[model samples]
Target: MPTPAGADAARRYPVDPNSRLNVRSGPGTNYQLVRVLPYGASVPVNCQKPGETITGTYGTTDLWDNIANGQYVSDAFVYTGSDGYIAVRCS
Candidate 1:
C-alpha cells in the first residue's frame, strides 16, 4: 500500500499554548465544533495557506479529504480569525 498524503510520517505542529484552538469541521469557524483541541496537542498540518477572508459555510465539513484516508480529518484544517491552524487528533 502507498503511504497516504499528510500521514503519520508528516511533521506535526505543536498547538500554541497561548492561542485558543477551536476544532471545526472544515478550515473555518463556520464549521461545527467536533471538539476543542487543548494546548500541547500535536496537530498534523499538511499545507499552510495564506490568510483570506471568506464567508462561513457548512459546519465541520470534510475539507482535508485529500490528505489522509478522509477518515482521520474529514474536517481538519480551519481558519480561525486571521491565523490558520490544523486540528490534530487527541490521544
Candidate 2:
C-alpha cells in the first residue's frame, strides 16, 4: 500500500561514523552476522522493537531497529539522534 500523501516517514541518518556497523539476521549478537556496513554507511531504520542490549562504542541499549525484513541492529550501535522512539512501532 502507498503511504498517504505527505505522510511522514521516520527520518533516516548515517547511524555510524567511526566503526563498521554489523548487520544481523536478528536483534541480538546471538543472531548470525549478515553484513558489515562501513563507516558513515546508510542505515535506514524501518521501525523499532525491543530486543537484546548491546554495549558497543556508542553505548548500551536493548532497543533494536529493523533495517529490512528479518534484519535488525541494536540501537546502541547506531546514532538515532534521539534517545527515545523516533519512528512508529513495529506491528
**Backbone clashes in model 2:** 0
On lDDT, the candidate that comes out on top is 2
Angstrom error of the Cα, residue 71, model 1: value is: 9.8
User: TM-score, each model?
Assistant: 0.42, 0.79
Query: Model 1: which residue pairs collide?
Result: 25-60, 27-77, 27-78, 27-79, 31-59, 31-60, 32-59, 32-60, 62-74
- What is the Cα-based TM-score of model 1? 0.42
In terms of lDDT, the poorest run of 10 residues in model 2 is 5-14
Q: What is the C-alpha RMSD of each candidate to the true structure, in Å?
A: 9.7, 3.7
Would you list the C-alpha lDDT of every candidate in the order shown? 0.41, 0.77
